[model samples]
Target: MDLFDCQIIPVPLTAERQSHISFWPNWLPRERADALLERSIAEIPWRKDSIRIVGKTIPIPRLQQWFGDPKTSYTYSNIRLQAVTFPEWMDTLRESVERETEERFNRALVNYYRDGSDSVDWHADDEPELGFEPLIASLSLGAERVFQLRHNLTKQRLAISLPHGSLLLMGAGIQGHWQHRVAKSKAVHSARVNFTFRYMNGR
Candidate 1:
């Protein structure tokens, strides 16, 4: 399997002056990955919640559990978030993520896609609490799912399959220029767990 490797190059996201680089490393082995996923499942209090979009609530099949600093507990669009102290396994993964992305994170929002049907809608993490151009480091495990990105202004689409134990980082003005989502798939029988680390500013 030819996965995308790390390279130092200036990524031209768009004509807009967005600046960021993704260093996707094959850091977590299958055994360690399973261990982390199982441990996180035990620690995080997963909840199934509805999201209000344009004054209408929608079906979001997955449950989310958050941890990190105590000041940010965002539940909805721009929902305020408070952090919980990190578990040891999470702390280890966080350190690895930080090293790969070269960004510091104070919080992590974890999502458990219990089956192939679970998904996240296309949205940008552009809340006031995230400040302007916040960075997000996402780690995927358990199953491979396609993560899609669309240009908010041009409608151009890009897709990448997120395999287990892989990481993707987005930062700078990328959030302002594009929106991303993990669309549903029907061929997989197992679940996938995604952990997105962010440094949220208290709104």
Candidate 2:
């Protein structure tokens, strides 16, 4: 992995305040971010394949991949995913997330979007396994992508670019109140990996 000279800096996430707990802290040194991303690609057990969405099993938006656990299999939006054990790098990252959210995470669900064509629709990570008032830590690495949110009923919108090394945290109430999505782009070439850490009680 190429070493970046820039330092990992955290991005401020408070622009306008909503009732839900949502945060975007991007402070990772650029170099460290590169190293962590490279290490993750090499060390994490990422897999390439298709998944069922809606009602039918379909291939991901593009050449998508994921790293998670067998028991972590949970599905929504026709997407079935397993939770993966945390890699050392991710474990360290998780600690930071824990401090930020003041909660611990046992499983991680990572998504890789190869380019602009790849994206996720507006959906909340409010699966049964995620528990009530779940704290989801989403860390972005690689290309910059837009993260969007809208009120479930009111249709109010909020959007931000989750550049490499940025972390977006949706704490519990956000799911009940909002739906988020990663919109498709037209210019990104490199891949973007997003790790959404969660705690599942049963489902």
Candidate 3:
């Protein structure tokens, strides 16, 4: 889709403050998106990472990998991910995203949801390493899913249906005041992959 086709959704943060989300429902054409989805599932080295919760080790429902400068690492929920240099295909995708969004992104956290049961819990991408008011560009491939967001203070919420090849940008300041998650669904049986592009300091 062209840049002018973007859908901007306003997110109210407070009485005076507001953030916004830019969504492109058809960022990539179906044929290309289908090929990418197949390549991602078959070629990428997906990792099975677990988190420690209340002294118990539990495997995360989804598989993920971090790609960026090899020197940079990301840690969240007690799981540390050492950065892997982006492969040629992924780097090309990143560059395309940069051009489309007109934003700089140096890192990507790619997640593979094998089925409906695979999901991510509500959380904010507010790590110190990301600096303040970070912009996140998320690209979805494969099955459609509901991306849910909730205000941290006011408890207000929003949900967006992310379809295959869609792109969504979480604007600045939203991370500080809101959390998002991809919840599990009983009816969805297909797989999905998401690439969350982010910028980091000292990249």
lDDT score of model 3? 0.94
Q: Compared with the true structure, what per-residue lDDT tens digits does model 1 show for residues 1-203? A: 33457633243467756555464646578798888778766767776677678998875688887787555466556443455677787888888888877788877888999888898889987777677789888899888888888878778777777777878787678788888998888987788899999887542
lDDT of each: 0.76, 0.69, 0.94
Quantify how close model 1 is to the true structure by its C-alpha RMSD in Å: 3.0
TM-score of 1: 0.85
Per residue, candidate 2 scores C-alpha lDDT tens digits across 13-120 of 233534443445454778978987787667666666566657676766743333345455767655565655555677788788777667777677777787888898
lDDT of 2: 0.69
Clashes of 2: 20
Off by over 4 Å in 2: 1-18, 21-25, 49-57, 62-72
Order candidates by TM-score, high to low: 3, 1, 2
Per-model root-mean-square deviation over C-alphas: 3.0, 5.9, 1.5
Q: Which segments of model 1 are wrong by more than 4 Å?
A: 1-13, 16-25, 52-59, 78-82
